[model samples]
Target: DAGITQSPRHKVTETGTPVTLRCHQTENHRYMYWYRQDPGHGLRLIHYSYGVKDTDKGEVSDGYSVSRSKTEDFLLTLESATSSQTSVYFCAISLRVFDTEAFFGQGTRLTVV
Candidate 1:
């Protein structure tokens, strides 16, 4: 089972506004990630945290930021919402840091208008 949960299953925000999405995990995994799923891009990584306060940018990290204050929680923030940022965001947890296995949350759908 996916032990990860994403808050605010759906959201509609205006462009230029700051938006934050939350991912909570109960699996106590050491690695957590934020990914955006688009029609053609599939799932593109936005950011990932290996531990508390330890985060690194991913392929599409521009205009985005992430924070991990606790092992159970990871947050992704869009500094300024943009039409291009509208997509389904997913949270993933892994038992291994190198992508051995991952469990994904239901996903949060965000629309920028």
Candidate 2:
């Protein structure tokens, strides 16, 4: 949590509005990820970046988009937020060459009304 930084750690917004969340890392890792936590689904990946300017969508990429313009920064955007989009968003970073565990940020709790 200390290594990774998330801006606007908590947020409240109206439906149909656009919102953006930021994640900053100091580890200089090559991989960064964005995820959302919900009750039944556990933790679902929203998007990820392998390197600067290289990003990919994850399983739950429908309403979310991501960008990584710098090695230590990743951003997740909600184009048009809805009530159903309210959830806790987390950012993770990993330096592993293969399959391994990743470090995560504290998380950003977002609520839409």
Candidate 3:
């Protein structure tokens, strides 16, 4: 989401628990994306939505799910968290048609035990 960063900037959870992260935007951007950051990987896309109910999986979509029911909100869900899923997550908003750079959230750090 634009302006606001990912919620719960830091979290730790046990393995196998369901986790939901939220992103909200004030600017009605057309494109929203979820991504994970890991050492050596920089950032890997998890999922993206161009409009409400219109979503597509990204490069690292496995074990993760996303939903966007409103223009200002996008959600990422981890059905069963694993150690491999412990990473910094980011939400980004883009205009798509314009040349402007995407606006990124501050990021959320999720640690699974």
Candidate 4:
């Protein structure tokens, strides 16, 4: 297996609440990413980490934040949940940022009313 798992597979929250999702991996890949899937947005990258304590914001990182303190864990947080932010979030791990196969977690489905 790719050794990727996500916590809180499903969540429902009121608008303006804070939500945090967790991703854990045992593969120890160098690159880890957070992605959000929606009807129109497709799969958009929210954030990614290259190494421990090394991370960067992605195209749709406006209301989201991510952190990586070790090789096996990545955390994603929505500062204030909103209906617009409701989507299926995924965690992926890859040996390279591009041109390589990436392993993805099952996904977390979140809905904000």
Q: Identify the candidate with maximal TM-score.
A: 1
Question: Comparing candidate 2 with candidate 4, which one achieves the higher TM-score?
Answer: 4
Winner of 2 and 3 under lDDT: 2
lDDT computed for candidate 4? 0.94
Give stretches of model 1 more than 4 Å off: none
Q: Judged by lDDT against the true structure, how good is candidate 2?
A: 0.93
Runs in model 2 with CA error above 4 Å? Answer: none
lDDT of 3 by residue, 1-113 (tens): 24755797999999999999999988888899999999999999999999999999999999999999999899999999999999999999987836877999999999999
Report residue 52 deviation for candidate 3 (angstroms). Answer: 0.7
Local distance difference test, each candidate: 0.94, 0.93, 0.92, 0.94
Candidate 1 on 35-99: residue-level lDDT in tens?
99999898999999998999999999999999999999999999999999999999999978775
- Candidate 3 regions off by >4 Å? none
Total backbone clashes of model 3?
A: 0
lDDT of 1 at 75: 96
Q: Write the per-residue lDDT of candidate 2 for residues 1-113, one digit (tens) a residue.
A: 54899988999999999999999999899999999999999999999999999999889999998899999999999999999999999999999637977999999999999
lDDT of 4 by residue, 37-89 (tens): 98877899999999999999988999999889899999999999999998999
Candidate 3 matches the true fold with a TM-score of 0.94
* Backbone clash tally (model 2): 0
Residues forming the 10-long window of minimal summed lDDT in candidate 4 = 95-104
Stretches off by above 4 angstroms in model 4 are none
